[model samples]
Target: MRLSKLFKNAPTTNVTGLCFDSRKVQPGNVYFCLPGMTHDGHEFIKQAVEKGAICIVHSKELKPEEMPVGAIYIRVADTVDAMNQAARIFYSKPSDKMLMYGITGTNGKSTIANVIRNIRNKKEPTGYIGTIAIEYGNVRLQPDLTTPDALFLQEKLSEMVRHGMKACALEVSSHGLAQRRVDGINFDVAIFTNLTYDHLDYHGTMKSYFEAKSLLFSERVKPTGKSILNIDDACFEKLQRISQAPVITYGIEHECDYRAINVQILPKQSKFDLVYQGKTYPVVTNLVATYNVYNLLAAIAALHETDMDLDVILEACKNLPQVDGRLEQIDMGQPFHVIVDFAHTPDGMKKMFQFGRQIAQTHKLISVFGSAGKRDVAKRKVFGELADQYCDYIILTEDDPRDEDPAVIADQIEEGIESSNHVFIEDRYEAIRQAIESANPGDCVLLLGKGDEPYIYRENGRAPYKGDNVIAKECISKYCRHINEAVDDVNEDESFIEE
Candidate 1:
């Protein structure tokens, strides 16, 4: 495809490749000047031109004097939108060729996307783009952002097409929506998991946050897409009214297009009756937590809208396993249970605790958690308060302190703990060890906050670190032998007492 054809209304220009990074610019490439939070792409215009960029597309107004002598400079109201459009044309609109289902909301987006991608057989060659990673066929790319830039997104979609993928499940973040990163992709189905107070630092208010998410279902973006929503969410009623696409509702509380009835949240698993189109499907999922039932229902509704056979969907659900870092369980033959969860938000933390309480019968629930620094300070106390109410014991530790003092963040969480059952520990590894040492045969320890994150963000820089799953496994193995020895010692003491 010619570069001239890619620019809908802009002047015709010859280009060889497309790029946003100045360092990657080459002769005949069109350099998209993007404006980011920290740096403006316009600042690198000279570098792009010097590197032999054929044309420039920028969000800001450009004066004739600012343009390179021979280089073409096109100014648009939004460079991000323009880049998305150009990418669509360059990639021949790959999203339209494959069935694309986009999952958006504050939470469950990644989990739902992963579950859907996992259940789909390899025969169709499904691709996934989300917080975890991007998978095209058998190839995988580690994800640096929840959603990549428009140009990169289009490139990935095109690659998926080349690999003969029949479907793609993408986790669309509000940041991606607000920035117009996924502006031109045509989604066959759009999913709304649930909207809660999150990313307020960027969005400013809950209303703004919802609006950013609403952009995904707007007529301009996804006019022909089917909207699968959680009707039980308070924001759904208003969103349903405004959404331009056909709506499909899924939930547990109220009647929806897809509903789960007689849902039982067990410690190790959950069982529910899935009702869709008046037909019932029994589901026994190893993906624990009542919250996951809603996620599973959302995925089912999306798959159903794709016209997949109900039996196929059910089979997929039954075989679907837990997503990594999302409520993953680690067992080392210890009498007690251990779980690692990516519950960063207050709502997520509360839900995990609720599930923990339900499954922790005849056992104590011990929780170890921390808050992310330089983000969402308001939720620190909320996490503490919930941890206090739910867990038998709570340890407030370090998450990603970023540039802030880890101790200060721990104190912020400590403020919400009204119960005397909680302890504050700034060292995360020590906290995990302490929790393990304190646990008895019937106690369950939960490591929360970090999830699958593989690094610790500190003031200096990000340091390589093992994920919660790894740490949990090590802690369990180290403590299980000690637990057995202690048990033997206790038995001998009891025998002497009896004698």
Candidate 2:
């Protein structure tokens, strides 16, 4: 790829690759000086040139004395937009050659994206990009963002194309869309799970957040593509008005194209009567709760829009594997139940508690959670209040405190607790150990927020974590006898969710 070909009004120097990080630059690479909230990429241009960057794309003006001898400098008004263009052409518009599914919402993005990738993967090679990882075929990499920047997204899509993937499902975040991180890719099918109160700190207001999510259906979808939406959500009418593509509606509370009625949530599975086109079919899925019914419907509707056989899709849906870190269970022959979940938002926590209360029934429900620092400080106390309402006991601790003091965050959450049953423990490990150690038989321990994430972010930096589920297992091992892995007949890896 030549600089002149990749960009207008540029030199004709040949470019080998595109990069944003100066440390990762290779010879002949076009290094993009992307701006960030904390650091400016322009400050690293010297290092980029030193590491053999041929073309420098920047938004800020630089002195001629600082420019490398042979490096070509091209100034743009927005380097993010410039990077998106360079990536699209450099990656040869990879998304255009394959099917693309985009899912955006406050919650259930990961679950729905995984569902799409799983269903498509059964027919042909499929890839996924979301909260979990960037995966297709034999490759899997932990993601830095729920939806990565445009450059990484395009690069991964191109890699998927080269890996012989027939389709890809992406979890598009509000931040990603607002930052123009998904500029060039066109979505074949765009799905909106639902919008709720989250990310208000960065977005400033609910209206701003909703508008950011609406961009997917309005601008990113292909002109001929479909928009799969949740008609039951409060923002349904507003989203429908802004969506440019054709809409396929799904809901539980309202009449829609694809609706799940007569829903039943058992401990291990969810049963619902699927209503579509004036016909009804009994649907049984491994997922549970009313919220998951929405996720299942969104995934099925997206697949059905792709012209897949409804019966075949339903059959696949029935046996779908459990989503990692979501409602994840830690069952090591413990007398009581221990569940780990990634519920961080007010809506998500409410749903988790509602489900937990249902599962506990007459049994005690114990909740262990913490609020993240430097984010929507208003919600910290709300989390405590919700837990106080539904939980018999509460253990509040640290959750990605960032730069704020963990003790301060704990105090903020304690302000909402009217009950005398809650305690604040700053150390997450000790908190989990105490909660599990104190629980009696028939009690359910609900671990919230972290999910299966392997690291804990704090004021200093990110510290290595063994994940909530793994830590729960360690705590359980202290009170219970372990099943020998040497026994072939008894598999200790069994889970309540996967059962």
Candidate 3:
């Protein structure tokens, strides 16, 4: 493609590709000089030029002599915005070619995106891009961000279109939206799960965090498209007010367009009657928890807005696969139960514990968890408090203590605990082993944080740390003995709330 065709301003240069990292620059590729938190891309202009970059798009000013004499240089006010626009045009505006839905919130973005993909994939070819993995037909790759950069995103969407994917579900994070990663992609449906205290290290305030999430419904979703929101969320009113698309509300607490009534959260399943447009449909899913119910409803509402059949949605919801690292069970022919989850935030931990307690019933509830270092220190105390309230025995350990002392992180968490039932273990593997070893028959061991992540990040580097799921199974097989007895189910009288 020619640079003149992609940009409004003319530059008679042949563009072979687009790139931001100079290390990946190739001949005839247009290198975008995007500024970062630490290093400036402008500093790498010489390297990019030396690597045969034919065109350069930059936000920072450079002297005439600094640039390669024959290379094309286009100055823009914001290089990120220019990159997004160029990427969209270069990819032939692929987001407009398919039905695209975006999900945003503090939690449940991955879960909801997975649920929607499962539902849509039953009828037509579908793609999902989120925290866990990116999937469309035979294309599967680990995503670096919940929402990838504009260039990578446009290229992937174009690939999906070529592969005959009918729709795509994207997990839009606050940082992604704030950084203008999804600037030019048009969403056919936008779903807001909920907002809570999280990512304060970057956003700094609850209002700013909410504003970042609000950009999806306000700017990305087409005006004629639909907005599916959880009416029970405190930020629902603000999101609804700012949303340009028509609203479709879903919730279990308050009345809404699609509501889950007569809900039953069991030990391994959730049964609910979905009420929409004066009709009720029974929904039985492998996902257990009130929050999972909300995720299911959000998926159904988003799909229904796209003119999909309600019966098809319900059938697909009933048979949906378990999401990776989301309250996933690890059963190695043992009498007791073990669960692995990615509940890093306070709200996420609280929800995990609520569901744990309900399913535990008369059994002992053992929790193994730790907070991430150098991020959201205030939540450390709250996590300790919640653990104190819920778990029968708490085992505090390391959780990606990047550039911070793991012992200091544990000490901060211990500050809020009034009970002496918990113990601090620096080694995550030892903590998991001890928790699993001490559990008796029918007891539940809950492993929190670091879900399916393959490495433990610390000191500006990552070490080979096996994911919680793999470690849990390995520990169970090593220590726990197989029993002929089965783990007892939860009591019928117990109830769960998304506290």
Candidate 4:
């Protein structure tokens, strides 16, 4: 392919592919020399050339002596932006062929994207790209990032279009927006669930984090489309002011375009009256939690603007499926209840405990959770504080202690706990076992962080870790067997009789 389309007749080459890593470079491939957090791709220019990269795209201006002899050297203002443009051209700009909805926030990105996918798939072929997995008509791809890089992202969108997918719902992460991963993709709608204390380690402050999230609505989303805002969030007004598109508000407390009134959160489901445009529509969903209610409202607002029938949307909500590891229950005939969630942030942890306590009622709520290492160390103390207040028993364990000592991480988390009911267990499996073993008949066992994540990271590498759900089910099964044995022994007694 020639660079004339992107660079205005700069140069031409028989480009076979695009790559960032020097190890992946092959003959005729163009290498993007982009700066990353830890490594500078410019330093690897010689290696890329040696590995058969035909062209070098970089931001740094190098002398003739430094440039590779045979490879084409091109300097641009920003290598990331240039790479995105190149990828867009290479992939034929597939984002233009499909209707894309972007969901961004601290807590509800996955759930909201899934809800939109369910509703959209009912009408036409719909695809999804998010934390869990990427899905299209018949393809399911496990992504390395919540949002893949510009090259992979445009390639996926092109594949979706080729597969006859008319629309897609993408979870736009703060890192994705900040790193310009979604640069070339155009969004028809951008939905903000809420902003809380998350990714503070990377963004440095909540303000910066909000700015990164705002980019989705303010820049990537089309101004002619819609921007859905959660009015109840503290960041809503700021985001509304910053958004480029028309804002559609949704909330439970405030009067908005879409409101959920008379909400009832039952044990297995949630019921609410969705008030939109002076009409009341009943929305009963399998998902239970105030946060989930907001997610549903966000999904509804995004779809409603696209002229989708409110009736069809409501019907789809009636049996909305539970997102994996998002407050999912593991019931193997256990006397007590066990719920697992991917609540890593402080705000997410508080909400999970709120829901867990509601279900536990007067019974004890035991929590088994840990924070991610090497990222957001500031939230560890807050996690301890929340667990101290909400849980009767707390077991602090490792989520992903990547290169960080699990004991040190546990100590940081323990510092905020005022009560002595918490125990620091470095091994997650043992921590879960202890929490489950201590559970009473009516008590609830809550597992947070590393919900359905398949691996545990150490200094060496990541190994297949038993997921929270799997461990929870194993514990519950043992308890169920004990319960059954006790019942059988009582039945075998001569004095015992059936009614």
RMSD of 3: 2.2
lDDT of 3 at 353: 86
lDDT of each: 0.82, 0.88, 0.88, 0.87
Taking all chains together, each candidate's TM-score versus the true structure is 0.92, 0.93, 0.95, 0.95
Higher-ranked by TM-score: 1 or 3: 3
Q: How much does candidate 3 score in TM-score?
A: 0.95
Residue clash pairs of candidate 2: none
TM-score of 2: 0.93
TM-score winner: 3
Candidate 4 per-residue C-alpha lDDT over 1-499 given as tens digits, one digit per residue, 9 for 90 to 100: 7655556656766788889999889988889999999999999999999988988998988987779788988888999999998999988889888899999999999999999998998899889998888999889887778998888899899999999999999999999999999999889999999888989888998889989999998899998989999999998888888888999999999999999998888766788899998989888888887888899999999998998999999889988776878889887766677899989998999999888887777779999988877888888999999998889889988888889988899899998899748888888988998888888676789999988777787778787887898888887666456554333322221211111
- Candidate 1 vs candidate 4: which has greater lDDT? 4
Better of 1 and 2 by lDDT: 2
lDDT by residue (tens digit), candidate 3, 381-426? 9999999888899999999999999889999999978874899999
The root-mean-square deviation over C-alpha atoms between each candidate and the true structure, in angstroms, is: 4.9, 4.1, 2.2, 4.8
Query: For model 1, which pairs clash?
Result: none
Question: Best by lDDT, which number?
Answer: 3
Winner of 2 and 3 under lDDT? 3
Candidate 2: C-alpha RMSD after superposition: 4.1
Locate the minimum summed-lDDT window of 10 residues in model 4.
490-499
Number of backbone clashes in candidate 4: 0
